[model samples]
Target: MNILVSDFDGTLTEHDFFELVRRRWPLPPEQDPWNQYWAGEITHFEALARIFAGIRSRPGELEAMAEATGLDPNVGKAVQNLKDGGWEVVIASAGCGWYIERLLKNAGVAVKVHTNPGSIGSQGELLMTLPYKDKFFSDTTGVNKLAVVQDAMERAERVAFVGDGRPDLEPALLVPPQLRFAHGWLAQELEARGESFQPFQHWSEIAEILTRC
Candidate 1:
């Protein structure tokens, strides 16, 4: 079996949910919990929860922002193509599953997802929480990406790992250079480490290449 594990926010979509949130909220560096996250003062899950709890969305605004997060239109086709060629695709996200699930369902695709659980409050607060306790639970990311990828390696004859964020670095490194696909931050970090990987702008492009192989 061939397994393809992907990150949700920036890897599967054009924009990270934080990008959309920051655009609207625009917190000052001193006040933002993200600043502490970058400084190694807090965990990734806490940073996300802190940021989301502060966003006061009004009714449809959050959903609209999610729509604007720009899930690639080709996602369904990409998943279909990969599945046809014997790839079992899964999403591993450090971000909220609320919008991730929303986007996938909206795109008319069904892919198993491992991510942080989240919901909206009656007053429109974006409430997010760490995932249920598991062996793969992470102190930083709500989901342990490295563990997820490692498990895929254990189950499959071949595994492909793809991602585009800070949390993706270690897992991306775990895969063979040829089977790793990266973009943005992950790409830059891999290049700095003198690692080799296929860079991609869209998941469809990745699907195309993987199916051909």
Candidate 2:
């Protein structure tokens, strides 16, 4: 099997949940868990959990905002193209799967996904939890990206990884440099490390490059 492992947040969508959540509920700097995360005082999972839990929106506001977020029109086509070429695509995300699943369903594509499970509280707070017993679960970030990629590599004849965040750096580096793809933070890091990788703007571009190989 040929595996395509990708990230779900900014890597797949035009915006990340943090960006949208912050736009709606910008916590004060002193109270922001993100500050703790950057300062090494908290875990990535704790940071996101606190951020979402801090939101006190009306019953349906958050849902509506999530539903209205736009995904690339070519995403479904890209998944199809990769599948047609015998690639098994899987998503590994440190973010909540609540909106990720909804967005993918709205896009009309189905593929394997692994992310932190979450639910919206009756009062509007989004509660996320780690998959405690999963093989790839992590206490620090909710999801251990490197484990996911390693699991895929165990079954795959060839593996390709794509991502765009700090959490993605390790896994992106685990894959062969030739099959690694990066954008945003991941891209800048890869460049600084002098690692060779494909830089892409859209999921469709990745599909084209992967299928051509």
Candidate 3:
């Protein structure tokens, strides 16, 4: 059996949701932890924890923000087609589970999703919970995407990964070149690293690739 692991955010949607949040809730340059993460001074999860600390809103507001983000129109159909073709589809994301689930549910796509758990705190701060805290790398993204992909690999005859960001890097690298699909920033990164991947811009492209395999 073939297992398809896909990233959310820019991979499934047209824009990066984490970036959208950062933009919508701009922090002062001196206070932006994301800058540290970008500069390799901190872990990804630490950056996220810091970023979420600045966000003060209700769950509904966050949901609205997720809903407003545009998704690939063909995603739902593509997922269904993959399922029909006997593939087990899973969304492996570094983004917040609440937001990812809301976005997919709103889009009418049902699939197993793994991501950092998030919630609106009593004071309205967006709080995120990391699952595998002990396994975090120095770049700690909180979400153990490599472990997720590795687990999938153990369960399937073959595993394919589709993604478009920094969080997708390690997991994508775990898969063979032919079984990895990357685009946008991820594509650029892979190219710069001289790694091979199937570059894509739409879900149809991914669906086509998985169908053939």
Candidate maximizing TM-score:
1
For all predicted structures, in order, the TM-scores are 0.97, 0.95, 0.88
| Cα lDDT over the full model 3 | 0.81
Clashing residue pairs for model 3:
44-139, 45-140
lDDT of 3 by residue, 1-213 (tens): 789998888888878766777888898876788888888888878887778878877657777777766778887888888988889898877777767887788779999877787877886677887755434222366667788788888899889999988888889999999999999878999999999999887766889788877
Task: Tell me the TM-score of model 2.
Answer: 0.95
- Evaluated at residue 177, the lDDT of candidate 3 is 98
Better-scoring candidate (lDDT), 1 or 2: 1
Candidate 2: residue 55 lDDT (0-100): 78
**Candidate 1 Cα misplacement greater than 4 A, ranges:** none
> Candidate 3 at residue 203, lDDT?
62
lDDT tens per residue, model 1, 1-213: 899999988888899998889779879898788888999999888888989988888889999999988888999999999999999998999999889999999999998899988999877878998887655778789899999999999999989999999999999999999899999999999999999999999888999999999
Q: How does residue 195 of candidate 1 score in lDDT? A: 97
Quickly count the clashes in candidate 2: 0
Judge candidate 2 at residue 8 and give its lDDT: 79
Against the true structure, what is every candidate's RMSD? 1.0, 1.3, 2.6
Clashes of 3: 2
- Over 4 Å off, model 2: none
Write candidate 2's Cα lDDT for 1-213 as tens digits: 699999977788767877788778997888788888989999999999998887788877877777655567788999999999999999899998888888889888899888888998877899988888767889988889999999998999999999999899999999998799999999999999999888988767889999999
CA lDDT of every candidate = 0.91, 0.87, 0.81
